[model samples]
Target: MQRLQAFKYELMPNGEQQRNMRRFAGACRFVFNKALALQKDRQAQGEKKLSYAAICKALVEWKQQAQTLWLNETPSQALQQSLKDLDRAYSNFFAKRAAFPRFKKKGQRNSFRYPQGCKIDQANSRLFLPKLGWLRYRNSREVLGEIKQITVSHHAGKWFVSIQTEREVAQPVPQGGIVGIDMGIARFATLSDGSFIAPANSFKRHQAGLRKAQQALSRKTKFSNNWKKAKARVQRLHARISNVRKDFLHQATTAISQNHAIVCIEDLKVRNMSKSAAGSAEQPGRNVRAKAGLNKAILDQSWFEFRRQLSYKLAWQGGHLIAVPPRNTSRTCPCCDHVSADNRRTQARFECVACGLDENADVVGAINVLRAGHARLACEVNAEVMASAAGTHRGDLAA
Candidate 1:
């Protein structure tokens, strides 16, 4: 089997390299915003959206133009990749996987990618990109596999490089028993085995400090040295919060994936769950503040990211992930096949009406989820058997 991984390192670029990187990142941002604007204009005019080839030609024209010829200073592939990114954004929007594409803002997630013109000298802890000579980096760990591409990003007053690589390895035999998980606000995750993982609450933990830093930033004059310094402080705090949350999620997912041969989770629509309750002017919303806080807590959990990590990690671990319907998972009773909203009178408690079985609501949800997963697998197996009797090949019903 082949596995792909990304190894990140902090780049130690010289002043000239830093300036060039900033310029290149700015040029890519400009190209992305320009293409997005073009698409928007075409949409307004009821015309067809621009194709990648058309956008590339437009990029060439922009480089040839006197006013924006500075774009030529950046690597052409990077500029093309910017266009590709915009293209993908539009595709995602149309496919309903994401919101509509938006214009890029300067200094927000400043980054660039090199599809082929990148060289890595691991022995010397140096990397080379087109138009940027070899630069040293902090070698945290040895990167493995064949390098596929490189991405340069700036955040928290530091630049980092992400190297995506691929390699072949023997198929892994899955270990451990199957488990079902219930994700929630009160508890991060409750497993069918009666154990639960706690929420990191990274943003909540840093909320007070962040508020202070933001207040300090607001006191400084806009664009002044003091203001820039304050802004950097706030940025660093935000980065720290993100890093903490990511670290927590990684550890939690890794543990679960390594120990479970099959993991079942609800198919949560996080975007819908976290949507703002603020309605438009004429129509007001009730409990807007409460909904906003709930939204924040849900976002803080990073449920979608957790599911994504579990998916790939489980596959690589030779395990399976099953996403069952989320309806009534919390309200359904694990005993006596009872289901009722009254069964969950409180957030933490559950009591079945039929057989009077009582337990923690989350644990009950996890148990019901596991039972649902088993029922689903049973249906699939029954179909496979029926199909076989009908002289057809229906393989890997649980896959």
Candidate 2:
């Protein structure tokens, strides 16, 4: 089996390389914004949208133009890749997968990709990019597989590289037990086996410091050195919090995926769950503050990120992930199949009126999820069997 993986490392670029990297990122951002502007203008003028090839052809002319001749300093491929990214963004917008492409702002997620001419030196802990020469990086782990692409990005005043690689590996035989997970803000995850993964709440942990940093930033003069310093501090804090949350999710998901052959979870629509509940002035919404707090908690839990990590990890390990409908999972009784709003006596407890079975609400939800997943799997098997039998019957009739 073949699998794709990304390994990221912090780069220790010298002054010259750092300047070059900044320029390269700026060039890519400029190209993306220009292309987007051109597309929007064409749309307004009733002209056909420019394809990737057309954009690339225009980019060649753009570099040759007198005013934009500085673009020649950057890697040609990087500019082309930026156009490709813009095209993809437009495609995603048309397909309703994402919002329309927006102009890139300076000092915000600056990045450029090198699809070719990237070499990694494990012995020297160095990486080679197209225009940028050999740059040292902290090689925390061995880079596995063949490198397909390398992305250099600037975040929190630091430069980093993400190397995406593809490799062939033997698929492992399915092993370990089946389990169901109930995800919540109070607890990160509650398993059918009665075990729980604790929430990290990384943002909450640093909330006070972050608030202080933001206040200091607000007091600083705009475009001043102090303001820039304060902004960097805030960005660093945000990056730290994000790193903590990502690490927690990765660890939890890895453990769960490694231990379960068939993992069942709720099909949660996180975007819908976290929507703002504030209504218009004509019809004021109740519990506005409470809903805001709830939204924060829901986003802090990173339920969607957890599920995404679990999905890929499980696939890599030859395990299965099943998502069951979340409706009535907490109210339904696993032992008696009784489902009612009254069954959930409180947020933490469940007591089925029809069967007198009592359990923790999360644990009961996990049990119901497990049951639903089992039923779904069984139905699929039966359908497959019936289809095979029907095919055989049709063949017999033809004979």
Candidate 3:
């Protein structure tokens, strides 16, 4: 089986190389925003959207123009790749998979991708880009497989390189029985086997420091050196919080994926759940402050990232991840199969009104999810069997 993976490492570029990388990132951002604006203009004029080739032609024209001649200094291929990214974004929008493409802003996710023209010398711990000469990177781990693409990104005052590679490996044989998980604020994840993971709460732990930094930043004059320093402090704090949460999630997901052949979880729409409680101008919302705090906690937990990691990791390990509809997983009683909102009178406790089965609310939810996943998997297998039988019968009739 073929597997694709990305290896990331911090880059140790010289002063000139750092300046060039920044300029390249800025050029890519400019090209993306300019291309997006052109698309918007075309749409507003009731004209068809420009195809990728048409946009590439426009890019050439922009380069030739006198005012934007500096764009020539940046890697042409990198600029074209930025336009390709916009095209992909538009594709996602038209397919209803994502929101409309938005203009890129400076200093946020500054990056450039190289489809080709990159050389890596792991022995020397350096890689070569098209415009930027050989740059040193911290070779934390040996890179595997053939390089597919390279992405250079700036984050938290550091430059990093991500090398995506492809390789072949033996298909994994899944092990262990199926289990269900209940994700929550108090407990990060509760398993059907009566085990639970504690919440990382990285942001909550550092919220006070972040608030103080922001307060100091607000007091500084705009564009002052002190303001920039304070802003960097805030960014670094955010980066630390993110790194802590990511490390925790990686460990938890890896353990679950390795041990469980099948994992079931509720199909939670985290975006909708974390939406702001503030209402429109005509209608105000109650408990806005409480809801805001709840939303922050939900985002901090990174539930969506958890599920995403599980999905791919399970596939890699020949395991399965099932997401059952979250209609009544929490309210239903696992003992009597009775469904009622009254069963969950509080957040932590669950007591069935009909059969008097008592358990933790999260545990009950996990139990129901496990049962639902069993039924769902059974239905899928039966459907496949039936389809195979039907195809065989048709072949016999034709013979």
**Whole-model Cα lDDT of every candidate shown, in order:** 0.93, 0.94, 0.95
Q: For residue 276, what is the lDDT in candidate 1?
A: 88
Candidate 2's residue-wise lDDT over 149-186, tens digit each?
Answer: 99999999999999999999997876698899999878
Please rank every candidate by TM-score, starting with the best. Answer: 2, 3, 1
The alpha-carbon deviation from the true structure for residue 77 of candidate 2, after best TM-score superposition, in angstroms, is: 0.8
**Model 1 lDDT, residue 232, Cα:** 96
Stretches of candidate 2 off by over 4 Å are 393-399
Model 3 pairs whose backbones collide: none
Best by lDDT: 3
Error of model 2, residue 112, in angstroms: 0.1
Local lDDT at 202 for model 1: 97
Candidates 1 and 3 compared by lDDT, better number: 3
lDDT by residue for model 3 (299-383), tens: 9999999999999999999999999988899999988889999999999999999999989999999999999999999999999
